[model samples]
Target chain A: MAVAHAANDYRLGAQAVADGVYVFSGRNEHFTRDNGGNIVNTGFIVGTDAVIVIDTGPSLQYGEQQRKAIAAITRVPVRQVYVTHQHPDHYLGDAAYADASIAALPATISAIQTQGNALADNLYRLVGGWMAGTQSQSPTSTATPGVVEIGGRKLRLIGTAGHTAGDLMVYDEASRTLFAGDLVFHDRAPTTPNADLLQWLNALDQIRQIDFKVLVPGHGAVVRDASAIEQTRDYLQWLSTSLHTAAEQGRDMVEVMNQPLPERFQKLAVHDEEYRRSVSHLYPAIELTTLPRR
Target chain B: MSRARAALLVCALWCAGSLPAHAATAVDTPVDPLNSPSWQYMRQRFLGKDPMVFDARVQVQMPSAAEDQMQVPVHVSAPGLTDVVDVLVFADLNPLPKILRYQPTSAAPDIGFRFKVEQSTPVRAAMRTRDGVWHVGGAWLRASGGGCTAPSVGTGQGFWQDRLGEISARLWPQQPGLERLRLRMIHPMDTGLAAGIPVFHIDRIDMRASDGRLLASLQTYEPVSENPVISVDLQHSGPVRIDAHDIQGNRFAATVTP
Candidate 1:
């Protein structure tokens, strides 16, 4: 199906969550040709001399469109782009940020180098023509954890794992805005194709201690408080516990996929699809652990 | 059998018998039944010239939509057929279409396992009865495709290497005379379709009782999911031993007690 040129454009708009901190909140849905694979939240922080992009969008067109949107707000050229993790949606747009220094955690960089192409291929199949010009782009540099000052603005990068092998959360010291990356998804069900639920819960605990006024999740609308983190943690905990219980009871994958979700998660976007995907991603290992050895 | 049921059976047998002679090419003919586009070719390849019918007695269960294309769960059972000699399972549109050949020598004909679907296709399970007739059954599965070519998540990180050949199994008591054996093996059933990765997958699994009587055997293919998990119900069980091997010549053995 051919998308109209008008609909092809992401039409990304920057919503200011805090002073000089703008978030391009994405649709709370899975990747599709209609959405142009723009099912991720990417943001930029405008500093006096330069701008720091939190994460890139899904494709080259998205990244270019995002760059134009950022320019509409500030002429400060993007000095650095921080990829939150190795997931395709977050990094496939790195090609458009060729002028800026793209950085990620070491593990995430390695993952991108190895599995990025495969992940990109999967997305191309899922999102169809929207992923036409998209390709996997490796990070240009390693993002070391800790505070770094650029253009008179200080940002703290917290290196953690759980969502994937490496998740980088950027904290804007000036605006007290924490770009929680995929570590904290608000109103959107978390994707666990490469997740360690226990580690993800620990990462959430780490995020809980961060002193930030505004939290910019990797997806969904920007939030102000710890509710988003709590939501992610609660959902992950319930998912882990339910999978383990299912394994202990000798339930098959199909049965586990069909398990009823808690009422609280009924409102979460893509809950059914994400839950089934998570079961396929994690049930085998859980089953291995729960099965008896005689 | 009832008069009408026996007559319908005879008609089905006659139709199946006349398929090869007639060389039927129709998509929905009784001989070339099932909604799959590749049923005719698959029937000829797997069942050869044997008489076959789309029998409701052979039940094949698969999700209508494959949430994870790389690991779609499937279950097949022919409880109504008593003298089933062999069961063949396959996907019609997969690049690697043949999935497995299961022989329920001493175990029940029911089995549950996982496999990969490259795209939206019909997955079929055909059971051979004592009369050499193939009872076919299947369901159409919708998927985004690319399951076989994509490298497994565990393989890139070397996660499966350390736990390779490790088998975890359990025997659960069911009803009075039956027992369910659920087992999982740690191996990335790589299809060799991905770049830089060779095809390495478990190809054979034999289940035996403690007394050395062979219960069931399954010959699998690369389309089987990584770290395959299978459940089989046994007619008689105390302790069941599982002997398996992959394409790389690695052998794994495990035993579970009831």
Candidate 2:
């Protein structure tokens, strides 16, 4: 069993999930809205000699901080840093961990490079000093898959498209730890702006087949039960099916969002406040239900 | 010159005088930006949820067309002084109705500013006088879509902080006594629409005066630009400080010398 500590601070923590697998928490702090709050990037540090980082945080400064934390655990040189997907927070920090061979799916690399800088410029202007000068620095490795490694070992990148194009999750067989990136959310509702419901549900099915005991999601706390994955999958299944029906019934996006989640999965944690954004993004993807655009 | 030639020359002058300005020779119909539901709600409310302020007499000036919807610059100003109490600009059918709202607290009645236009939509600006009345003016702007869907620019991660200048107070006057000045800063009034690596949006922004007094507060949407720059006329001279805080507790402050 992984030891639980309140530590007061949300950013700092470490727990051994299995014999050789250790999970470290990240800074989950972010902006609050009229509805709820946003989940910032918090990744896991895996392995000893040949360490693999799950997801890089938001900026170069944050990336450096993540590296500093990983170094404290083990002095092993990081062999590879695998980004969960190509969002600014998860991948932009690639610069700080520049020495490590950065690896992610080709699509993720494209999303980061093509729209990365422009997005960063817009955010920097809005947040101002909160940007920490990360705005001015150019994105280090955009759309370039430096070290491409496909499915292997205790960890394998499973394709999940409901969240974003080229969204992938790392499955750890030894520890049964699925670093489900943004694929699974513990408490907060998942953002599906770039998602496809049908493909997302199928990805969930694929994730279910993995023999894992604990699931550490892209957002929220570490979920130690395999059922949590099933629950999230089921939620997506219900949402996708119901939303499709609703769309067919000529229901608007807001009505679809207002529609409550399945009572059975209500106990399963999801960020309900983020539903509007999810509906806005997923509706388009679901409405276009054909083949995966990517 | 002969009498016939003189008569012909007079006719030519009359024709020239009767014609409009070279640029005004052609007037193209404006496009509407609020085609989507999200944007439609925004434009309707901006004009005044009630009695709908419409700028009927004022002339609306915009480039007959625009290429970039993301950074399409919009300027709204009236040439003559009339019975104008307040001026509210609307990007008709934009997600937000009141794109720009101005009430003249100064001697000058003319007002001007810029905003991020969401789509190829009609942009309207209205002016209301001190007598509790409202007037409006409008133009069409051609903008691209997916600005709200577009990811936020810059580091959309971590707890970053900085200061921003205020439009109402952070103005440097060449002379003293309530200078009508314009100040702008970059910002993304994320409408909680765009999805980041971690799915979320920047929701709230709070602005305050140098002494930490309230100046202006606004709730933004994805319809606003990735980086939103707001311009406002101010009545102050000297070193003024402005602080802006986002919903994430990210704070920015700045000081300007007039």
Candidate 3:
């Protein structure tokens, strides 16, 4: 069925979040054949002489479609592509930017090199025919944490962890717009497959100090305020505290998973599924600590 | 009578005299059967030709699909079956079929643990009562596969090096005169299927009272998840001393009080 819809068009549209900065906000859903894994946010900044792309979508087709969307807006060639993290959804489309100098943090680059293929394979199984020729491509260069001017545009690359082992956030100095990767989920439930909750909270604290006019989260709608960051922090704190309490009580994994969610998080998209997945990922480690070593 | 008819009559008489009285009744087949390509072979290999029945009293609980294949939670309990001598848990389609063998010596025949599932398979729990009848219970679990073959996250990240052999435990009252002891240890439990990693896992564990009375014993295999955590119900509400050893001769011991 997915192959029959091989010509599936993402119909991606670029929304202007700031001057010369545009974001293609994806749907708040998981990977499926119908969505073609187009459930991640990606964007590009049009500089005076060139364009800088931030994070690619899932699958080669999505990336190609994103390039086309950018082309319709500006004729500026994409000079640099920044991969935010090692998550398959963010970096699996690296193959589309073969001509550009695709880059990520050093750790992220290594993770992509080591685990990218496996992650891509998993996505293929989840979305099926959408991943026809998509291949995991490691970043061609390393992105350090500092400001770098290119094509008359000043951009700052912030290197942080917690959402993953390596997460890179892009900040445009002129427009004062911050592209926060999976580190901040707005209305959607945050995924925690490789999360370090404490580290994530610390990273959020760091992000909160930044002065930005527009905040583009990795998922969900763009916001002008810090509500997304605060919401994410609150949900993560609740999740951490609840899991700690359950582990301290010596509750089994199944019981912890079946526990009712807070009424507030019930409104989040895919909250139940993401919460169960988080339990499976974080419960074992928490349980190991709650019961003291003898 | 002819020679052939006389011989056949003698054989029938011998078979009737040797068969047990319960054998007169037909053994009930499993309602769902948990049909798999490897079912017949695995059943014959594990249960042998012994008298067995698919009993509802033996409860095997697991999620319909594994959220994490590396650590699928499974709980097997036969509270209604008294004097359960041996309990065997296995996955029919797993490359390594046997999961663990649990002996509830002085404890209730109830266990909670985690294991790795290689693929979609029927996980079965067969408890042998004192009468030599094996009561079987099972559930079909769907997984994305590659659990046992994939290297453990902790091991790959070197998180278990310094913490190896560390034991953590807790005990609490579950019901009237019954206490539950939950414990975990740090180990990789690699299945040798992964590249460059050798076979390594905790092979055996013995739970006893502080005064040296055996409560239960468990023999685990590579299919057991990393840093194995297990909960067992005991009749006594007192301190429990757990002793365990891995295939590599590493020993660990801990004592916990309710």
Local distance difference test, each candidate: 0.86, 0.51, 0.87
lDDT of 1 by residue, A157-271 (tens): 9999999989999999988999999999999899998899999999999999999999999988888989999999999999999999988877777778878899999899999
Rank by lDDT, highest first: 3, 1, 2
Model 1: per-residue Cα lDDT at residue A59: 85
Q: Pick the candidate with the highest lDDT.
A: 3
Name every residue pair that clashes in candidate 3.
none
Any runs in candidate 2 off by more than 4 Å, and if so which? A1-11, A26-41, A44-48, A122-130, A135-154, A255-272, A284-294, B1-258
DockQ numbers for every candidate? 0.40, 0.02, 0.44
Per-residue lDDT over B1-258 for candidate 2, one digit per residue giving the tens place of the 0 to 100 score: 243244334433533453334324212211122133333344344433322223334545444333234444444556674655566556654554445444454323443333455556776655655544344455556554544345555435421223221222224343465443333434445555455433222344333446655443334434544444333334444444545545556555555554
True contacts kept of each: 0.42, 0.00, 0.53
| Candidate 2, position B244, lDDT | 51
**Interface Cα RMSD in Å, per prediction:** 2.1, 20.3, 1.5
Model 1 alpha-carbon drift over 4 Å, by segment = A1-7, A292-294, B1-28, B31-34, B48-59, B63-71, B77-86, B105-108, B116-120, B128-135, B142-167, B185-204, B212-214, B225-227, B243-254
Best-fitting candidate, scored by DockQ: 3
Q: Residue by residue across B1-258, what tens digits does model 3's lDDT show? A: 143244334433543454456454323222235556776677678887666666666777776778889899888887678999899999998989899999998888888899999999989899988877777777789898889899998888999998987898889787776888888888999999999999999999999988899989999999999989998888887899999999999999899988
TM per candidate comes to 0.83, 0.49, 0.86
